[model samples]
Target: MEHNKRFLLVHPEISRNKYNFAGIIDNEPLELEYIYSMLKSMGYEPDIWDGQVETVSLAEKLKSFMPGYVYVCGRTRQESFMKEYCANSKEICGSTTFVGGIHAQHNYKHFYEDSIDFIMTSFDMFAIADILCGKSLSEIDGVCFKSGGIWQENAPKPFDAERLPVPDRTYFYAHLDRYRYLELLPCAHVRTAYSCPYRCKFCYRNRLNCGVYSARSIASVVEEIKGIECENIYIIDDDFLVDAERILEFVRLIKKNNIRKKYVCYGRADFISGHPDLMKQLKEIGFYYILVGLEAVSDRYLSDYNKLSDMSCNISAVEILNNVGINIMGMFIIDLDFKPRDFRELYKWIKSHKLRHTAISIFTPEMSSELMEQYKSRLITDAPCDWDYLHVVAKPSNMSVKQFYFHYHILAAKLFIKGWREGIYDFVDYGFYIRTILKNMFGFGG
Candidate 1:
């Protein structure tokens, strides 16, 4: 038979828990769409299978499509599922399996298995195309592959944001109703930058692209935004509110182009607090939501994490966003050194600010981060899925694991009740979430 050129790109499903906030938020697999577009540009047929929204099983898809190549991408939380999908693809169709993403980039050794044929350490689409054209795997610079039953890795090249093609959104448009962000139904994702600029110790995003930051041209970003079918655009940058002049130009271009769209993005607390004028300009440009990382309410924790912002900045950020009528999704991190009183104090602080939309995550030191070395001695779990920030993966200094979970659950329950009463998250099923929380608290289905 002639060499098959069909490709199947998959997005793995996540483990179910209250922390997943499933049904509340299901983002489109933008990465797979990028791969799909690149493959199509190369004159190869490619299909996407998003496990979050797909009803059919992987086995069924593999049998039906009979693709010659299968590619899977996901974060650390989806590591197990990524491997499983590759194993299934190899077993069912004997397809060439490729695995890549943030997790695979940093920990390629974990995927050195017989089922996986290649591991991409960077977004080198041309290298992938070369492989499809019968080029030897050893010739690729940023990929790992088996040679004579031995795994060999090539040095990674620097990633260039300019080389990325505009992601084809045919799959997104086909399943428009399945993707959402809280109340923002049928939302779309857009990226203006690669990696992050800051050096927060616990963040893995800044470590991407070899710690280099690059932004696409403002004109190109605006052009892409104007073509999007959805009114809600989630600018999926690590921090969209980085450069004042750049952001001002973006706002100006949006107005000039007459492109009306609501926006969501990540921003630093210090930026929002210092540039109240910029915040006002963003609000005027239809900025509906900003997810600020108010990691902790204490100055000590901020300094320890190298966050470069104090609690005062966080307070001012909330006030500024509230005044501008922009919703603030405050993300907080709970440290292992927290005592029982600390959780109560954090809850009290959140309530005092009248912040209805708050996300509390346990501090998890990623395997790819520098903080992992410091926590290695105190580590509790080696499982990749347990590092999702929802699980306590390290020994606590002030409390036992059970005690820490008890306090954390209590805090989450309180916030959930407050959010429910205020009608902040009416789109999600309240009963279902409440049941999930209880089950996790009691260790029934956790």
Candidate 2:
């Protein structure tokens, strides 16, 4: 046990496909910020160096910080870098290395090497404090570690979001200008809730937090919003619009306190379509952006994915949001079963509806996603890193892999170009997006 130990939080560097604007936007690592605040409360000094935004080398930062413990957080895409950074940090400072977040939570078995010392499977700050305080590893719930050359893990305790500390945003505020969401530059992200309540077959959220929904109190959320110095606030909740009463309360509190900030949050089609009045109220209270998962245009496809909401619901949702003057960031999935006509129909629907902002990801069964088990044998690449949504990982049923990509490239180009011509995004962003698309199209691999 060490007293008053300094800890360093590292966000592993991972490359994103430059073709997508959403992929390239810099975002505050709120997860690490939460961990940092927890460590501080435990009387440990904590500092964060984000690989996505920081210019210094991890080794250089490690050397300068000379922390007794190094904690890394990342998704599956950044697994290799996480391992590498932890290994390097251990070499630099003999730091006890720990890993957490999505990659480590579900795939902790993959990280039980000598280089890594511990992995956190839950977001419980008390569990984390106990571990750092040198409590017996076996007794610490929600932590996985090796004892006497044997790997062990305790049963995870349920996470209560209400019990969590308000994330100390001092570090994030210093780097606020770097984070953006398309046109919403300098965006600050906060989550009012964790995980989604609805079971969408393709989502990996179930693995992240046992598919249980936990929400912070409205008063706490409003307090966080009021402290945000950034002009734009991005609510990273999986489904912020799920509870109509909660939404109404949040809006009421915001107006009551005179707290104002441009906002964005996720919503389901059914929720928006069913609650037009609330959507209007949201817009009136500075909610100008909403990211809706309009997975497909076909009701059968929606049924196949178990999206719960059908095409008509998606249409109504888009129309309602548009009518209220809220910018909709439509998200769609490109299934392997799609024929050329399906692509055409999807584009036609977008055009007919005049949908300006959109995100189209190939139906990727990312590691730990429920759909991955069914599509495992169908995967073209065994490389875990290729599971990023940018790649076509699964074998197409209706067409060859090459042909599926050919149509994908054309569809992507058309979507971006159309958006640009229609002035959905700025001209500076348009040039970068166009260039990235061209590079990926003619390049060796996407």
Candidate 3:
């Protein structure tokens, strides 16, 4: 499929685990960069409208961009609002449109009805391109659409990640402050690899072992980093340190350029726990925050979430990072599967670990991986995609959703209040709550 085209990609601030908003890490929309590069590769231009910094009236923006297709991706949180706006955008533009991402992909036709023309789920970008190039949705894979009052499914093609060009970081550079936590100039987010190679039950990318992760060559990656003239960048790799040789080459490239940018990337505790000295070097090379998923302080509990990493590894990794003077934002998941008694231990765990700058999200069934598989089996409620539900997703193996949410809320409240008293997080400090009180004259977290 080959034809000239143009597109507009919109990403909603949907909740991955509901509470992601409570401790939002303002970041650039990498999906836009990916699609921008892919569209540019296919001789098309894409304008991205990210709704993170400010709410965008997409229809008004669409009139200016006049794209051939408008694409939106988000899960549970703001589906109704997004669907309404995307439908309105299509109506206003009089152009065909598609909506994707996990929520839409799994239940596009079921949810949006006549609003969306096409839905792409399960890493089905190629099929989407083909459809936009004028192929029928029936011919694509990982797409769903309503046809004659029925939802039709297609089996489409998936492309090799290495074949794709580096995401044009210009869009990101143009919208720097919109990213939540960066206090730098020329901040860009770069994805080093396409799919993840983990089997963590809560993650979205591990939907199917996608493949032995194919990585972009260090030479190619560095070319883009330098080409962008970036003084700082966020290595948006799911886990760049997973592949050590690539890590060495990547670090070497930054060292050679002496060109610098602060980087933030996700990683497994096992990776850092095993290579503290190397990670210390990465920090000097602009890797500011190594966001590790220290899901729990217990191997048994963490294993229940399929974290794979042992509790000792998680602690050791955090210790190493702190010792190396690297700021750590340890992400932990409080299970809905435990009793109220679990909260005391978890709090003790956090305090003992001195885990400041932490984030807690309720578990959610985001992708089609183990989480969703279990969710659909009546094990967990589709865990509402609301921003508040960020951490505990569903009925735990042994607790009701109500009991789970109640205790989970208590735990988070304890953490936030404790930190507020001690001045742990900046944006979420007491000042923010005071402002909210003055504005809304109500308690916070509404």
Runs off by more than 4 Å, candidate 1: 16-20
User: Which candidate has the top score in TM-score?
Assistant: 1
Per-prediction TM-score, please? 0.97, 0.96, 0.83
Question: What value of lDDT does candidate 2 attain over all alpha carbons?
Answer: 0.83
Q: Give per-residue CA lDDT, model 2, range 1-446, as digits (tens).
A: 35338899888666654433443467788888888888888778899988877889999998898999888998776788888999998798899888898778877887888889888887675777788766877888888888788889876766877876778887777876577777677888888887778888888774456657889999999998898788899998888998999999999999999987899899999999999999999999999889999999889989988888898899999999999999998999999999999999999999999888888888888676557788989988866566677778889999988888778878899998898788776625556667877777777245
- TM-score-wise, the better of 1 and 2 is 1
How well is each residue in 79-134 modelled by candidate 1, as lDDT tens digits? Answer: 88999999999899889999988899899999999999999998566667777877
Determine which window of 10 residues in candidate 1 has minimal summed lDDT.
14-23
All candidates in order of lDDT, best leading: 1, 2, 3
Error of 2 at 297 (Å): 0.6
Worst 10 residues of 2 by lDDT: 15-24
- The candidate with the higher TM-score, 1 or 3, is 1
Q: What number of clashing residue pairs does each candidate have, in the order they appear?
A: 0, 0, 19
lDDT top scorer: 1
- Give residue 9's lDDT in candidate 3 (0 to 100): 81
